[model samples]
Target: MTTPLGGAPLTSLEQDPAMAGGDADSGDAGDLGPQPVVNRTIGRRHGHHGRNWMGHGRRAKSNPELRGGFDGLNFHDQRYANGGNQFSVEPPDQGLCVGNGFVMESVNDVLAVYDKSGNELVGPVDLNTFYGYPAAINRSTGAYGPSITDPSCYYDSDTRRWFQVVLTLDRVGTTSSLAGTNHLDIAVSQTANPTGAWNIYHLPVQNNGTQGTPDHGCDGGFCLGDYPHIGADNNAIFLTTNEFALFGSGFYGAQIYAISKKALVHGAASPNVVLFNGGDPNIPAPAFTVWPATSPDGQFAGARGGTEYLLSSDAVFYDSGTSNTLWLWSVSNTRAIDKAPTALNLDVSPLTVQDYAVPTSLVQQKPGDTPLRDCFALTGCAPTYLGYPNIVYPTPRPMAVNDSRMQQVTYANGKLWGTLDTDVLLADGTHGSGINYFVINPHSGGLFANGTLALPDANLTYGAAAVTRSGRGVIAFTVVGPDNYPSAGYASFDAKIGAGDVHIAAAGAGPWDGFTGIPYLAGNRPRWGDYGAAATDGDRIWTASEYIAQTCTLTDYLTAPMFQCGGTRGALGNWATRISKFEL
Candidate 1:
């Protein structure tokens, strides 16, 4: 078993005797320099491994079969199988692959499980049949009331059990849609063996529910919140009470919500829970929960929250051009989330510099625009320059992470490897076109390397889908080509190398390749859901279309061709589309 750093303990920066002094820029925040990466793996690991068995890819060539029977001819809108986003857990040793599954349209959308092997653990079982989605939403406001939906799965080595925390929506009918009467469901199961029975139990919130409104903004509509994240800490599932924010519009705010292990999941409700709520105008109403570690120096210290919730700031509110920053809160324990002085508190302390005066990548200079520095590698390509973050310092910097984006600022391998979107620097250097890739250390806010890939003139922006980190490399992709045309999803790549390691080639420069034949996925499309597909896991090597699910071997990705959200009939109505899984 991969043990957590420092026994996975929780420590507060506020409680740290040595870390008490200095501002975020004091340059003394615990040697934020790049240290060798100890754990080669990223994110939580999983268990329960068996042999491999191949299964034929779903062969239905029609859209009806691809879209789970929804063909857009009728208003066959199916609410989220459980009103929550998908849950994922990667195996420790076999960190190369991860397991991800969601509550789908069955048994009232009971949660299901899919691991690295692409086998369904829950295998056609309704999550509700085992647990239940007991919460509701507020009709007028579209706010979610209490009853867990934020389901997070973790492997417990101590008991060999999988722990899940359901974050219940707190407002009845507050956010009504086909996605089940707006509720959260956190259930626990011990499914170590694929063919074994699960010991499933639904966890509960204190006082039988939440105390505040559905956390919908006063104006309502798009400015609403949902999607809670739960983590293990202090022997409890540490939850954040932050609002779930709508993306692109870029708004943020949420607090810590906690649930105890002894309560609900263990069949008892004790010690009222408390939730943190923050007030800010530019930002939407804070989500009712945020994941918090009791202390900063503890094991959970320097660890980033795996999930986020936010209130959409731009949709309902008029011309708030500013992208709202999602505020976060934390709960020390589940049972005391709503009742303790320390339960719901802000995670950012020492008043870290709110504005680092850092320019968005859209306004930064390109590495090529400057001189070649750092390390560089070349193929048949021309000799180029490689840069490093302008400076190096030690202070925790604010980086937003979500299902849409996985941002990390860590010191590893004795060289600070900062990774972020290339678009942030394009507008200033390259007219915001082509592949945008950069490496900048967050601690010092320095620009290490900034440049575009030598693609065959593909206008790349953040449209390149998702960005994820592997061993010592960074991978990002986007749907590149004309905005209106069925563009190709191009994957940009780069990796850090050790000096003593093989200097087979230059560092940043390499032969550019493509994951050819990645056709534009045309199916059920939503305004935002269709924007870009999410990567299967943190490896970020490949991103699968939302409509497609692969077979057991990860050889091919399959889906329906007629996947449409609001548009009229087409493939979104009845055609299935499958694509070969090829690396770029």
Candidate 2:
């Protein structure tokens, strides 16, 4: 779920405010430009939050017309219940990784471990428990603990270890004033077995405690790191975050933390930390949230050894359909984290891609293949009501395109691969949410191939991609609209065909009505989380997505304030994250 920053419209590409700096040395050997400083203020800390916002839902009528499509594929799906009605909100911000004959999947607050045969071995427990904290405590402390949102994980084959990252936040208004603190919690599995022990570490991100003092890498202490993404190369693990102020008011810039992977895997008491931000002397101007790229084979063996790559879009806000530039950053000397690490802004021709806008309203129709009417109360509309009485008809909420930040990135076969969701103008002149991907030559900073995947009358968003050694890859994503539920699907890709035909991995069981407990919008807003996960296990591609599983759940929306729909609500639904593996 994205923190709403105000209703201000996105600025045009020409008026983008963050584009005012000059180019620095492009991380090539010997160019050895300026090095980033070490931020020693970061270290381990601990606490636990007792209460959390476990969201609510709306009733959805299953539309059969939206049920089945494009099932012809050579892959088999074995999906078990990952997380659903018993836990968090609409879309469970899903995270999954497969390695060493085990599967680890995480939602907002809980994680489940599974064997290679799709059988649960342990967990479905709160993150606090897995992080070695007491389950019940005051959640308002301005200390380090697992707020546990935006969970991302990676499995390193070289070290036979697993790593996961989540944001830790102080309860809103914990201080006398409304200020709070934010932290990043990191965990590295002690062994290949995820059910085993883990080395947990925490780093301070923002502290709004001081009214006017500037925080470590922001204009002030009010900065909060939202939407954290984790990735790794052979030498180091990188975490990228989009920094915002309290209540989601201001956008500062992206923050990158490069930690020594070897140190973490070996249980070092203290690992060196290198922090990068827009304020850094070596970073280019107008930088936003740059996504750190993960190695395709779980190890970095590219032309530039010991280097990690980062990618970002020039557009800051969503619905900005004019930006055409994608920025690339390379950090070298990662293995020597104890010493200075060189950060370079690489020069590359920005790939020319289609611009996009906010998606329109989508409908979850009635059962029996019936079409949904724009107004359910109108005459001759089948099944009188879409879900229940008093439910808003045609609930309007834009699909999650929270900035054009890269969703998932991979480094394979000496090339970089990445994809993101955007509102694109199709060749047929229709505007909808589609997936845009790029394959780039990292050394030359040139685009080898790029394309957009958009279905004729469907909307696609929240996409993740995984590439194999043979240049074969698969993209996993969610599709939803009036003619479809929130379904999970994928498409194969190769150097021969950029992206092939769409195949339905799992069609949603019912309609995704809306979420509860929000302040301003009440029960109509849909929560898609920030992103999904895609990984490769040497020969196969593994993916996960949040899809609607149950359409009707009992919900009490009247318990919250500002809700237009009061009383006990039925037809509320739950999200079941699907994890599937297929050959590419």
Candidate 3:
């Protein structure tokens, strides 16, 4: 089922003629103008507790089940359920690519390919095999090689090529510490067919001695690129990463890497790389996780070449104060990347937005269903036939919500669109998790329009959006709370106006898991995945999310048979992914 391809080490920058030039600077690189002030708050409210859960221990005295606010518009339809293989434990970390009448979906370590009709073509294969590496590796010391995680894929219509990227670590056991080498592996399809041979490139990610001195804000001794996101324009491709100290000791800031898209797609032996850090002299303090936005329709309608943009939220932690500013970075002269003695220009700018508080835990409950107090104790009534010890009600313990970060972004129809998870004030005066959608004028650096979408009692988080050439767009996100199971939902909107009412695209079959605490999870919370994905193929928008399977079956925790449950070597059904196609 798998093969071993070993690892590819970083090539010497000097040996590569394309990287001979000195780094470029835009107006003294470090001297950015004064920070952009918040023009005005779009969604403002009071009585916000940083991390409050209203339904933690109390049951409703008497009330009907709460439902989402619907706009009465049904312009979207699910074309097919291209169910993905179960791969990762919690928080599925899903990604999707659809183009040329084909679809490809990837979870943490597994990838699957299908036709437009949802017919399986190839794969359900381990990421290692596809990357030319051993199928399985030693978990403790990483004997065979580093384990692959956090994969993202994109389809480039201009060149008819597909790109897949993943982060590889030395060993699976040392996740909390940066004790071994780390790498970001990139694979570009040689032709339109994804199942055929491909070119693989690896870039070292750890802060080793050879990585050059880090910027002032980076932890020089132990830097690792965590949560790498991918985006692209016609002239170049971008990879944004959150640089962190090996053991999560310090947050360094975001790292943006630019590569030649033309060179990669053409099968060049070695492609030149340009790197940018937010800390240098521009965005000095309180800046982290700069997410790069990719153009959904491929490069903008601009008349210029070699230009790309990135965005970041001033606030990092969920408990941090409400943020009213967004940092923007523009990299120009990217066309010079492959030419020696030429460098790219980088600029950083900050813009003010409406002050928004950090998101709080969402409540999801079924009618007359008492919340499970102790899932491990097996003392509560079960919803599905799986019986007790299943994932507890409200799935994630303590009802924690995702942080406010731009989950996914797209550039289309002369506008940049993005969405993030945030706490919103409902019409009834209740605070709930909701999606914040905002648009920006890339050319003028102005905030175009922004609004919030929240249901009465439901919490929505981990959202993704895509836009069409006609200025029509759709947003896909997860809905969960005390009144509902984790479900996949979406809202469509006309870019000229705003998003329509919420619609449940696909509902979860049951609770995610019965275990309240697990080592892999952060603080024993149910892993709802870092983010979902949405992309447009010019006419139709495709969305994907981590959803629960309709049936229950035992599954391994992570290659260990002893970790099974319910008298099976591997019991406890895990979360699965679903890919759906729709039109606005």
Candidate 4:
């Protein structure tokens, strides 16, 4: 277990602390110098031919297999098995951003855009192709590119540009293996239109200075920037990631980068990029998944040359099991990043909030008819099940509900709102997956509200919230357990009242029967999505989450060509994504 820097809350974090510089340009202790980067867009994305998984490739992760005939449980009343903009993918790393009447949704490796009336505008394009690399699975040839995953996006209304970011571990020189060097690939729309041209920028975050990046002295060869997310204030956009060893040991903590929005909007040849000293530098211990918050359009912080706030939890970071200390971070003076050494600063303060701990349960799924297992047992699935003739998946498998890290966050109503997965003791004394949320006023270093959000017998994972300028918001999550089967659900909340009941937006069709949880592949450790993404478009809150959209019997699955169960899924996995919207 890794221990964090501080344990107690810092008393009196008032604005204008009378440090060396003013509040915006205070240049506090342990502040690192900013690095610069150059970039250009390869070209406009080709056509919208979103060639999905064809159940090919041995090591391919997202070969979805549609489920079927479970223990007779129906999640929703939607006419079709799948719902609106519903599609197949494994471990839906949801990415959603709404702006200028356009909606964009990006999952594990695919992306698409639609109008307010649900008219398809742009993609369903693979991330690789969009990033100017070969698709994850080349449609014509069975070739692949470096792995790309964990995507996050936001529409910076201030600039009328949409920004999308993902992490890619470069393949070892054309071979289908990791090169131990990774980068944060970001694409910015040239205009407010989603179907228009875009510019792509790469930040070589291996931190070993291999790809023109700064050397942070990584433990292994280089570092992998996992779970990349983006947010913005009025003047600049910020990206954060969890640094881990690309090929070996070390979890180097979260890395942050601040870029000038003005420079990016104009497609500058070289833009000023501020790379902060992360966990490896021993600066105030280590900050884990310090998520940057997105504010409603035109509601950015105007004081101190525009301040962007981020929130993180050190509870699970120290592995002390539970904690109440929440780290509140602010980036000041982003307006002048175009000038050298212009006070692009980071300030961290630990605020004592509600206690939150990791979930005590394994996030179990509903009892279902194990068709994959049934076939492996009845017909002795040979090479199909990794050539193992002795593999048997149980009736009701358990889904992995990993650690309690901060999930989704937003800055609205002059406060910071965020939540993460945790454990809660119910009336029956049984521990269940729960949520701990906090609404903080960063200037004064105080929380306006914080509480637990949960249901009686279900588990909620990857909960995300989006708020309007008036404080009206929605919380989206994946609800599953002995009774629910990983359905897309949500709740309503505001500045005064906390979250309401967990409402199901789109019901799950079956259990999460992905390859990662198979005993032969991994050790029954079910692979789950990192986070759900929600954004505010005008007065509406747009959200997306992972769910099971289709199910089929073993006979239907085997009879279907290439295991594309009636166009519901692929071969090795059956995860689906559901996009939703709420009126604020």
- The best candidate by lDDT is 4
lDDT of each: 0.25, 0.56, 0.57, 0.66
The residue pairs that clash in candidate 2, if any, are 1-529, 18-286, 58-572, 59-571, 59-572, 356-423
- Candidate 4: residue pairs that collide: 63-571, 63-572, 63-573, 64-570, 64-573, 65-573, 67-551, 67-552, 68-552
Residue-level lDDT of model 2, residues 441-543, one tens digit each, is 7777777777777675566677898888778888888876556677787777665567666666777766554432121222323346467788888878888
Kindly indicate the candidate among 1 and 2 with the higher TM-score.
2
lDDT of 1 at 254: 46
> Model 3: runs farther than 4 Å from truth?
1-88, 136-144, 172-179, 211-220, 301-304, 317-320, 340-342, 365-375, 379-400, 426-430, 514-516, 519-522, 551-573
Cα lDDT for residue 353, model 2? 47
Q: Rank all candidate structures by their TM-score, best first, as comma-separated numbers.
A: 4, 3, 2, 1
Evaluated against the true structure, the overall lDDT of model 4 is: 0.66
Clash totals, every prediction: 117, 6, 23, 9
Reference-based TM-score, model 1: 0.40
After superposition, the stretches of candidate 1 with alpha carbons farther than 4 Å from their true spots are: 1-116, 124-160, 163-182, 191-225, 240-252, 261-272, 280-299, 302-345, 349-525, 528-584
Residue runs of model 4 more than 4 Å from their true location after superposition: 1-89, 138-142, 280-282, 377-379, 382-386, 426-429
lDDT at 160, model 2: 90
Name the regions of candidate 2 deviating beyond 4 angstroms.
1-87, 136-146, 171-179, 207-220, 279-282, 301-305, 317-320, 339-391, 395-403, 425-430, 516-524, 553-573
Q: Which residue window of length 10 is worst by lDDT in model 4? A: 35-44
Write model 4 residue lDDT over 53-153, tens digit each, in one string.
11110111221211111111111111112211111234557888888888888876667788766666665566777788854444234344666777888
